[model samples]
Target: VFCMKGDYSFERIVSSDVDCINLKDPVPLLYLKDHPGLSYNDSSYSYGESLSEFLRKKDVGNYSCYINANSPLIIRKCPYDPYKHHGDDNGKVMKNCRDNGYYHESRDGACYLCRLEGKCGCEHYGFETFINPQKTNETGRVSACGSDHVIFSDDIYSGVEVIYNSENGLNEILYLDPHGHKVKYGMSGF
Candidate 1:
């Protein structure tokens, strides 16, 4: 594994023992470049800093990078003025994993998390969560709908099954147990 030291410096570590551990600083998992002067870190990136603090310290000209809330591995770029993306005080930027600078919308009865490779179909992770009702009365609106979340760990059938349903607009979330039984929860718990 290789860990980053500074902006461009890296340290390479090679180990044979199974229990060997390297505690050095890791490379930033992702980079969002609008210009050249700004960088970002998320809770998952292990950088001992926050986006709010990093922006405060540097003289970011017109653009800055902040952690995208949808996924920690994604870093989103924004205009420096107005503190954050328009109308969103949490600075929750959506992921644009396509080359055309757009995000993949939830469709086909599943929620998709884009892969590291840009513009390809979501082969990395997917979820079956609540869908927003188009109107006050929407069809396929189940009083209780369970998700069929799928994670392609190695692009194979091997999986570590878990349960979850993100709230979009449905009334309740249903999680599946290891035995494929439904476990229900109200919208508040989601």
Candidate 2:
């Protein structure tokens, strides 16, 4: 069996061939010390520490290991499953759907429909009418999420007049009613 110190939390064992090896047992230093061909200067030597020290130093860190076998021993980062689904036969996200539509152990997991809607509005008008319209201001101006300037206008009045003359150009008039609703006049350009 191939074994290595994983990220400093536990010993990682990866092997396709099923064989029982009590890795929890302490690896005698004498066994490794007498191996002249094997170099101790390599990072893999860290796994050679006493069983107690190896267990104590377990945390999040990369590690390597060497065995006196023909095929050089391999060490790999263990796949972490906070939900404890590592040995599951079926590769489903959750064993069974819960109230939130995902396993309780999974973090931030929710219904697929909710996730899709959050990522992108499902309907074309759902984004334009219900979502985007709510974000517009009185002048029908909307500031883009990532930009400084307003990039879109859904003004109710598409044809309006330029009332005042300015040094730059003709300035359009935006009138507001008593109820705080913008009033638009149809007078066509300047």
Candidate 3:
């Protein structure tokens, strides 16, 4: 696929791919802005370094199967800052995933790790592990009324809006971010 190198905007009113009718014999996968800066990589038009196409699935179907506890991915700016997943420290940042996933804000060096799955596969994994009130509040106020604990993920871009695509159950899935841009990733595990 070919990629657009620099920041650019279309000057002419190229409504559809038909505008480039006189440029080449046959049109490629998508339309091009008719610029010299465009380069031929896989003979396809790309957006940026990582973007191969601009919202490839323009005619995508209905979206469903929403993610839980991860909305508007809240970034953990500092250690002292509160509002972690479970509404408290989860020990995810302090307890290295490479070492052990167990650690909590209430107690240091605790062995209990929140095993709830993480969401994004990006550099920072934003995920949460639900807590059981019966286990956490055996004696305190939790014993009066039942409630669930929610953990927060660092670098949460937004509540992950994943649409289940009927195409091929793979990477073609689209994630909608109400606050930011949507991203595509593999659905191998999901």
How do the residues 1-190 of candidate 2 rate in per-residue lDDT, one tens digit apiece? 4344765454556756432121111122322334344322211222232322322233211101111211102122123244334213332222121111121111212222322333222222211100011111123221111100011111121211122222244222221122211111111222
Worst 10 residues of 3 by lDDT: 139-148
Candidate 1 Cα misplacement greater than 4 A, ranges: 1-11, 14-114, 118-130, 138-190
Candidate 3 per-residue lDDT over residues 73-99, each given as its tens digit: 111122322322211222333222112
RMSD of 1: 18.8
lDDT by candidate, in order shown: 0.23, 0.21, 0.21
For 1-190, candidate 1 gives per-residue lDDT tens digits of: 6666668766677765331112211112322232233233432232223322333344322101122211222322223222112113221221111111121222322222232222222443322221111122122222211121221111111111121222355221121222222212111211
Q: Which segments of candidate 3 are over 4 A away from where they belong?
A: 1-156, 179-190
Residue-level lDDT for 57 in candidate 2 = 37
RMSD of each: 18.8, 29.6, 23.3
Q: So what's the TM-score on candidate 3?
A: 0.15
Output the number of the TM-score-best candidate: 1
1 versus 2: better TM-score goes to = 1
Off by over 4 Å in 2: 1-28, 45-77, 82-190
How much is the lDDT of residue 13 in candidate 2?
65
The lDDT-based order of candidates, best leading, equals 1, 2, 3
Which residue pairs come into collision in candidate 1? Answer: none
